[model samples]
Target: MAIKIYGSFRSPFVMAVALAVYEKEQEFELLMMNIKSPEYMNNFNPFGKIPSYQDEDITLFESRAIMRYVATKFEGQGAPLLGSTFSEQALCNQWLEVNGHSFTPAIVEMAFSKADTESSKLAFEKFEKVLDVYEARLSVSKYLAGDSYTLADLAHTPLFHIFMAVSDDEKKKCLTSRPHLHAWIQDISSRPAWKKVTERPENTFYKPRTESQ
Candidate 1:
């Protein structure tokens, strides 16, 4: 079978994985399963989470793992998913860990807090601190991994897209507050492939809400 991706567009993690596939000039079928359902839990990912990838060679779960798989498999076809230099590659891994273990959680909490009576203020405060680190690093480098955009930078694209769309106020938070980070965000967000990915008819994720975003 063709590469089959299991998950909904509702997840930024899922969207990032999809973006990685597209960046590699490949297509995949988007399959959303009720993660808690027996079939999904048992046959796909026993952990009952979204975003599993399958093809003739093997099956995979976790967005980062899936992205890595695509990067390794299609290395010759598209954007250098992994960095060219050893140091850049190491930074790529470090930043991806930040995307997973640090930055995304606070930012996601800030997003989900919109749906419930949660501590959005605290989340925002925490997110700002994270952004501060990004601003510092970006002031020195053009992309997260180095001079060229890598998987680490691509991983956060969907996130910054949503953050830009929540509201004008939120969008400004992404730009007006952090000059270096904002510039890097704007640069990466301007990719033609990213525009195409968002415009895909099958997309069911959050829509852009800003006039310029």
Candidate 2:
């Protein structure tokens, strides 16, 4: 059987996993799991999360871990996740953690608020602070892991993609206010594999560009 990615497009975490698989020249069967179902909770993710990866070698949860595993297991096939030098690898790990801890939450909160789910100004303020840190770090390096594109950079792609599509102003905020962050997002978003993902038939939840209408 092919590699199975259990989740839906609604979950950016799952989309990140799908991005990684394609970046590495591999395809996966995206299986949406009923997060409430016993089978999903028992066999895929104990946390009952949307994204759970399963392959012949192992079963995994946690998007970051799964991305790391895929990169190492299939290192030479696609974009290097570990980095070229020891310091680069360290920086990669640093940014990946930063992505998980600092970026994801704020982005999620802000997006939900944009949808009128609840208040999110506090989340937006928090995200601005997080972007400050990113701006500082990215000022020097071309990519998150110094000169190379790593899983670190790949990890944050999907969330920003969705966020940008929702609002042109938000897209401008995410990409332009900070010089390096903007460049990095553009670079990753332009990749062919990622383009393929956005084009998939099953991907129904599209937030169109403001100019589309």
Candidate 3:
């Protein structure tokens, strides 16, 4: 059977996994499941998450783990996503952890929290600090993990896409004001695989809400 991904594009985690598959020159069938159902919980994810992956070899949950598996399984197929050197690999893993722990929380909070609220203000502050770290790191390197685009960079594309779509210009200045972070976002978001993800019909939900809208 073809690699099957049980989730919807409504979850950026799911899209990130799909992007990883594409980067590895692989294709998968996107499926949906009642995450709370016993069958899904028992066979796929005990935690009941939207994205669950199954292939001939393994069944998996957690988007980052799935992406890591895809990258390793297809290491020789397409873009070298694990980085070229030992140091780069180490940095790749480090930044992947950063993406998970440091970056994701703040962005999610900022995206979902209502504007002009204390919670929103706190989220923005935290997110700005994280972006400051990225700007400093990206200013000297071409990609997050190193010179090559690694899973670290790939992990961020979907989140940034969602953020850009939902944020107003005033809010977006948090990203745009940081020249390096803005440039890195442009570079990663422009990838053909990401373009393919965006073009999928299932990805119709996160349209940018501009001032006019």
Candidate 4:
């Protein structure tokens, strides 16, 4: 059976999972579900989340978990997303945690809040600190988990895409100011799999905007 991903590209979680599938050289059916419907709740995700994964073997929720499963299940097929070495694997997991606990919150706040507002200022402060951390780490390493691209880096791509789409030049200075971090974003965002994701019709809604636009 073809893998079915329940949600739309509007949800970064859904896009992340789709990117993982593509990284593994797999195809999936993008789908929508009435998340609150009993059929969806019982069969897909009890919590009624936007992205739920269904394959021949199992059905799963939680985007990170789905990405991990895809990376592991399709290992050796395409890009080796789950780190090739034990150390890389450990670091991959560590950075994945950082994406969840530290990075996501700050980026979410920055993306959604009104510019120049008190909340936006606080978010920028927090986000800049996090970007500083990334800049330092990426300065030394080519990729988050080492030289090889891993789920750690993949997890961050969609959020950055959305940030770029909605942010103005002044706001984007947070990302573009950090040389290494900016380079890393460019590298990841340039991947062919991500290109396909962005080119999909569903992604039209989040098309990146420049200050002049």
Candidate 5:
């Protein structure tokens, strides 16, 4: 059976999974459904969240887990997303955790919080601290897991795309002010796999706001 993904492309989590599949040189059918429906909840994701994945051997939810599976299952086809060495692999896993726990939460806050509110202020502060750590780490390493591209780097591309699209010039300084972090974002966002994900017609939901509109 062919691979199938259930979710809206507007979700960064869904897009992240798509990016991973493309990086592995695999194609999938993108499906949409009522996630809260009993059939979907019971079969795909019990939590009623988006971005569930299915293939011949398994049904899986959670974008990160699905991404790891794609990387492993198609290990020889396209981009080597698992990192080249033992140490690099370990680092890749570590950074993947950091992306979920540290980076993602802060970016989500910054993306959704109302401007000038205490919550927005706090989110920016938290985001800047996380970026400080990223700047320090990326200053020396070419990618999050090391010198090579890995799932660690792939996971952040979609989130950053959304964040960059929604954020204004001032808010963008959180990334642009940090040279290493800025450069890293530019590099990862430029990959063909990611470009493919962004170019899909379904990706039209998160467009940047123009002054006139």
Candidate 6:
């Protein structure tokens, strides 16, 4: 059976999973549903999350897990996303954890929150700290897990896209001021797989915000 991903591209998590599938040189059907519907809750994600994945061998929820599965299942086909060496693999998992638990929370807050409020200010402060960690790591390495572009690098593409789209100049500087981090962002976002993901029709929801808007 063809793989089916139950979600919308508006969700970065969904986009990340889709990017992973593309990186593995596989195609999937993007399906949508009322996530709160009983069928979705029961069969897809009980939590009613946007991205749930299904393939011939399994049904899964959670975008990161789905990405891992796709990377491993099709490991030989496309870009080697899981890392080429034991140290690289270990570092890949480590950075992926940081991306999920630390970086995502800070950036998501800053991206969606109204600027200039005390809360937004605090969020930016936190996000900069997270960016600093990335900058430091990236200063010495071309990719997050090393020279190889792994899932650690892939996971951040959609999040950074949304961040850059919505962030004001000050907030944007947290990323841009760091030369290495900015360059790394450019590198990862430039991949053919990520380009394909962004060019998809379902990607309409997160267009870059204009000043007039």
Measured against the true structure, the TM-scores of the candidates, in listed sequence, are 0.92, 0.91, 0.96, 0.96, 0.96, 0.95
**Per-residue lDDT of candidate 6, residues 52-130 (tens digit):** 9999999999888888999999989999999999999999999989988998988888777786799988887888888
lDDT of 6: 0.89
Reference-based lDDT, each prediction: 0.84, 0.83, 0.91, 0.92, 0.91, 0.89
What value does the lDDT take at residue 11 in candidate 2?
A: 79
Selected candidate, larger lDDT, 4 vs 5: 4
Task: Write candidate 3's Cα lDDT for 1-213 as tens digits.
Answer: 799999999899999999999998888899998999999999999999978999999999999899889999999998889999999999999999999999999898877888789998998899999999999999999998889999999999999988888778887898889999999999999999999889888888798676531
User: For model 4, which pairs clash?
Assistant: none
Candidate 1 pairs with clashing backbones: none
Expressed as tens digits, the lDDT of each residue in 95-125 for candidate 4 is: 9999999999888877788877999888889
**Which prediction has more favorable TM-score, 3 or 6?**
3
Candidate 5 lDDT over 99-192, as tens digits, reads: 9999999888777898899998998898999999999999999999998999999999888888787777877877888999999999999899
| TM-score, cand. 1 vs. native | 0.92
Q: List pairs with backbone clashes in candidate 6.
A: none
lDDT of 1: 0.84
Candidate 3 least-lDDT 10 residues: 204-213
Q: For candidate 1, lDDT tens digit of each residue in 117-188?
A: 447777777888899999999999999989888899999998888788765764466566788988888888
Q: Candidate 4: minimum summed lDDT over ten consecutive residues — where?
A: 204-213
Global Cα lDDT for candidate 5: 0.91
Compose the digit string of candidate 2's lDDT tens values, residues 84-133. 99998998899899889878888777766754333666767778888888
Clash list (residue pairs), candidate 5: none
**What are the RMSD figures for all models against the true structure?**
2.0, 2.4, 1.8, 1.4, 2.1, 2.1
